[model samples]
Target chain A: MTSDSRLSWRDVRDRIHEHILTGRYGPGDRLPRDADIAEELGCARSTVQRAMQDLSDSGLVERRRKGGTRVRAEPVTRATLDIPITRREVEQSGARYGYQLIRRRMAPAPRGVVAAFGLGASRPMLRVEALHLSDGRPYIFEDRWICPETSPEVNDLDFTEESANEWLVLNKPYTRLDLRFYAVSANPRLSDLLETEPGAALLVIERTTWVDDAPITTVKAITTPGYQLLTGS
Target chain B: MTSDSRLSWRDVRDRIHEHILTGRYGPGDRLPRDADIAEELGCARSTVQRAMQDLSDSGLVERRRKGGTRVRAEPVTRATLDIPITRREVEQSGARYGYQLIRRRMAPAPRGVVAAFGLGASRPMLRVEALHLSDGRPYIFEDRWICPETSPEVNDLDFTEESANEWLVLNKPYTRLDLRFYAVSANPRLSDLLETEPGAALLVIERTTWVDDAPITTVKAITTPGYQLLTGS
Candidate 1:
């Protein structure tokens, strides 16, 4: 406590978190104002602000503009998931990554694809089907659609050497993203593609991105059986 | 652009986001300092700081303590998942909620349960099996384990009317949480409990919570077939 003025935001955050952990402030309890905490702890108000922001981001507390901050009455199990590029994800897991373009063409957006982008009318989208391999085994089979208006350069890329997943993540900056997770029983075609047994339960990650209301891309990455997506905070 | 003096943090955030969306600032580009952006926009430095915080939380930009901020070259698909209590979740989705406690007893921790808690040895813990329903149809089947030392009050509560999920969330304040998502093919027992066919693909959410390293509870909530979990930002 003697180094109160020198305490960093992390220190302040830990102190406040300890208070909650020790039952000093119970569930649904309103926390002290930023100014009061700053004055009492002998730290800058901005430091307290930073700590509170971290707590809010992690779903420990709820912050309102004028209503002040309070511990969440029914605390949620909050998790942040950061899905990376396919090749990078494979390589990071210590696998030798490979890519194979299964199909590529300019086709009218399908009903599902149109619905995913919230488009009123079907448009010609660059459809790319590819398989991401980790050490010669299929890791993910991606079926993707890219809008030509937003990503005209996608037409120029052959997609054989690099996946649309890798290329888009590197070149495009999206303003919005939607991600979904679900399970599906592998059909004959899917089982053959993923080299898994028929009726195997597989996890699917569906992602869509856009910029300024203009659709960029939507992809469904179907993984092999026994795939688990994990996050912790 | 001329209303710079009256701009709010949200306004500044949108302007900077516009630069990224319009390709004025490409991926991996370092953004201006908070002070520099404040001076350019004719706003207070705190305003820029607030805007940057928003961008960072959304995973659009990465902020370092002294290294400043930069546009992410590989933008991760960041999703925030708020898992709520089961009854509330069902009611919020406009469904008639129902609960039934299938079984409850103090039993020795199973191998998997001990491994989940990282305990040195197996001990007697409260094991609970319950089913959540929507309009008398099985929705989710939960297998749960609770540490009696951490949650002594759980013994007094009758879970027949209200689920253990809701009771713990309301009473216990966990300092740590671990969540896992995966898929499983329903076995005979699980199929009977969830009212699904054997070999049906189901989504499973495994959650574990701790208070200061003392394990509070761990539960595996297995949703009925065709359930999908989604998040967007």
Candidate 2:
């Protein structure tokens, strides 16, 4: 690509980003208007807008109408549909991450799980309960349920090599996914797995991924005591 | 707005929403695909897609490619930017939410705030600190910085009726906001406001809001002993 083509929206955006990050352009500074920026860059305003979009996506900048551009002051944590791979995270942390499949079954999911997934009383589902570990320490207890109607092939898949999310991403392409977070008092079942007293405060993450509006899987994770979740939209 | 032009997409969307909320289309149910739904409704596939988007946005439906649509097994909590609203939240709990404007000053924002707003060091800024009471009990201590050079009218406004956010929204429209949540050990200042012992756990929320690319406000809120954040996203 020639210089003109290389003068992409990203190029304009990065330049602006560099200025903000380097303090060349301070926070609360009014950005040059679209026409002015386009003129200064000798490019289209659309290109500048695209760059701003990229910045916004990364949580690096805040955009406002009529007010203009501003540098974000908070530490931006980029987490997107994080693949809940404690193994990968622990390994990256130079700590050992391990998992043991405590139990596995192909029975109907519990009533709450069924209701959450809108599964009927008759639909047979796969449920897996396991204790995930970090260097031989209990890390998370996972209770997972999946609708065979969405992926009848789950019964044939193995859990030892990769996570369900990894398998689904590769074998089953999902169009969308929803992740939820909340704090709850841990129950007897989870307290033991997490090494916390029953009724201990805990952070809960529930995820339901789908392919074209069809249910793929539902996984609820209970983390160890004192785990903090830092995520972004 | 006409009945016919009301668009089959919206009609199907409303009907589907009512079904889900009413428990007719329970979770985990496979939704008819574009062609099937379009045929049943005597509408275009595009219409079905648009309707599906609404369901997806509302955290009620999951969409996957080739898999089809499914009711969410668990409703995901939508995460807000978690704007610092101590009074509203504290009072909502039936706790007395109070504010003591401990200090107020007009000067150039600190380097961080100035840089955040892309403003010169000499630009006028406002600094305000206050305490929030929950049910007649102190719940939060807030410290805020604003770039009034970007919002000249803010200097003349009163914050007694609404909150800082409400005031800013009414006076200065923002386009983007960044929020961060973290756990910190309380220091003396925070401990004093929250009425907690030093080193107690305090949930901190830091935020920066902007318009276009211009930074407007920066805030840090320190919470009392009982702080809860609930979100499904």
Candidate 3:
């Protein structure tokens, strides 16, 4: 809708935004031409134009000079999806941080892990289970699987010294990383590790790092008590 | 260190990134002069300079010709945090969508809700609680708080028919929204509302919206599993 609060442009802008968000007008759906909308809504074309501009600026719609306007094909790009190391995140929030690697084992990748890391189902991978702490409190339960073929150096690692993220950055530096972010319901193990109640809400981040285009490691980190991530242009 | 595979640039860049990330050289912390770093790392000053440039390009550092360089204070500002609705997120992953409002309350704001909305602790507020489904499965729980002081009309709505976000965009208009993203441990109540085991990870979004300078709403939505938020330049 037009955000012309001073002159009722808001009414039109909101109308358009509502139509698009509610799926009355799906992505790629063309909007009524300004003149047509003005007639349909019984308002001035100028108001419709103003509202269209507002929606376009917020990435709700895409406008072209003579091509008309269409709802966006996708929502505008968003923020960090796969949660990253709690050490970095906590430090970002001005908190002190520490980490411990509980164990490192070589095991066959689980089905979910294999698919997520894009590895062969039967591949034996290096798995590391670790805990990240913030101000001495358990902050994250991180479980990771590394493709042995991608980083053979996993055999020489010592989890008690530093985090896998740190070790890989310095020892087996990756060339690229794929990250996924989302929310999940906590399980008993996660709740116990995070010191929260079971079935509580937690933010989960999964990442797969690649070296020379080869998938290297898949890391999953879950956080408790939640925190906000901020990003802007 | 530099990213030069043949040179030492890669190591230099990684070194600098490590320092910035690990708080060895924190926000607003200045890097030593080019000569100093080159000497310390046993690399050419040009290589160190290139490394710094790489960090700058990645939104991790700042550099000036002769003034040396300093770590950036506003790291999150470079984050691309976009607000999204359930349909869009689900469809992006080739999944289906469904939405339902399970609970709705119009009463005094709770402790966190009141403070976030700037409403008095005893002031009345409107609260909306709902679950979003994907392919017939619970995917998200939305807990939204609207300050009656900001929009007195919100208390008279039936959100079961439509989302409060949609209603606000249609009936109540606003500009300027402050969004923060973070990992959150789910509270026990949220665990049950979302049908997840307690303490499961959740994707939490907190938004404080405004028109001009008056706050309108403070919304916190928690989403279920397989919901990944991703963004890039």
Candidate 4:
């Protein structure tokens, strides 16, 4: 209803992107104002604004409060990754989802866990070791540490019927999140747990979350060999 | 000036996000209309719209064309990843950047390359093998294939002085991109090139890009051992 023309925001965005691809607007070049662009393209200003927002979110442009929009001097390959709960992932993959709780106890946070949370010192936290399976095959081995001070409910519930991954993701909303991906060689323990050969290359995803200034949890999810993580388009 | 008060879009976003965190609106619950929320909060409807856009982008909610906005039933941990040019990445890390072109020739697209582009048949493409160095040490080994039909200018450029990674990123823009990450064990050839021990676990970042439906390029950036890719935030 905003525009009489049939041009959608996606069409406007593609047009602007074509301008950049064809060098009409080079790097660091300022683009026309939204009103000007809208007039030129015979569309509504809101349409142009939506297109500009998309370009900005994709790292193709920089928009300032009053300085207007400009092409980024250096473009990056920006990607969005969506990591779902393990059970959902397996189910969506057409596999029977299974989980096993290996170990659970309270222990002092390790040096790595402490560092991951950016804590001043180590503290007693709940440590959980679990394995996710797909079709009775080992899928991922998770080593997690939860802060009881932040979520006291964790101390009462045993993580047997439900996984900490699913529980925390649903109950605990994080204000800040840190994610990193790396590769690790499977050692004896990891090989045994994952049912893979020793020295097999494995992909590792480490995640740390915080609510305001309080650390919630930090986890390292190590996958079996040949597992690949893909971007969500 | 949208709001008479000092509330910004981020303030509105956090306030609404807090509602979700406190269980005021559970998963799959529809939110109040933007105008209603704006009236309640004494802010402009556009402010609420911006907040809802952010929440939707972060996968916390879903907005429909006419159904309004609702909390996502299945929540996902969404992260944004920004991969800069190899040269810029090294320079930003305060290291001297180096590049080496191992080989450059025209070859038939391999099975993996064809599959990456979702092409039905194999065709001749420009194959470029290169190495990126940090402080004169092996950093990333890249195996790339460029579809000359999509990017004919690639046939004229020699990748000795400037890397293909930098050149393509600066010149050619893609409409679509596919990114995947996995682990690979260094074989004898990979070990010799990367100067790592055999069986060392290395992270491989595979990227395929397309302009509309035409495939632009596909590259596998094999990173050195201990290399880590982190989220932008």
Top TM-score prediction, candidate number? 4
Tens-place lDDT digits, model 4, residues B32-106: 999999988889899999889777755788899789999998888888888899998999899999999999999
lDDT per residue for candidate 1 within B1-233, as digits (tens), equals: 46778998878988888888788878899998999999999999999998888777657788997899999876666677888788877887899999999999999999999998889999999999999998889999999999999999888976888889987875665657788888899999999898889999888999888876999999999999888787777
- Please report the TM-score between candidate 4 and the true structure: 0.89
The global C-alpha lDDT for each of the candidates, from Candidate 1 onward, is: 0.86, 0.65, 0.69, 0.90
Ranking by DockQ: 4, 1, 3, 2
TM-score, second chain, candidate 3: 0.62
- Number of the top DockQ candidate: 4
Candidate 1 DockQ category? medium
CA displacement after TM-score superposition, residue B157 of candidate 2 (Å): 7.2
Higher-ranked by lDDT: 2 or 3: 3
Candidate 2 CAPRI classification by DockQ? incorrect
Tens digits of lDDT, candidate 3, B1-233: 34443456778887877776678998789988878988777778889887876566444567875678988665421323455556667676687877788777778777876566454455666778877777887877778877767787766777776777656644454566556656555568977777776656667767776665666777877766445765432
Q: How much DockQ does model 2 earn? A: 0.07
For model 3 chain B, the run of ten residues with the poorest summed lDDT = B74-83
Number of the candidate with higher TM-score, 1 or 3: 1
DockQ of predicted model 1:
0.51
DockQ computed for model 4 against the true two-chain complex using alpha carbons: 0.60
**Per-residue accuracy of model 2 over A1-233 as CA lDDT, tens digit each:** 33554488767876887677577767556566767877777888888887876665554567785677766544232223333355655676687878777776788677777666665664667887777777899877878887788898888876765666445533443445555554455668777778877766555667776655677778887767676554433
Error of 3 at B4 (Å): 13
Model 2: CA > 4 A from native: A1-43, A50-84, A118-122, A158-162, A231-233, B1-159, B165-233
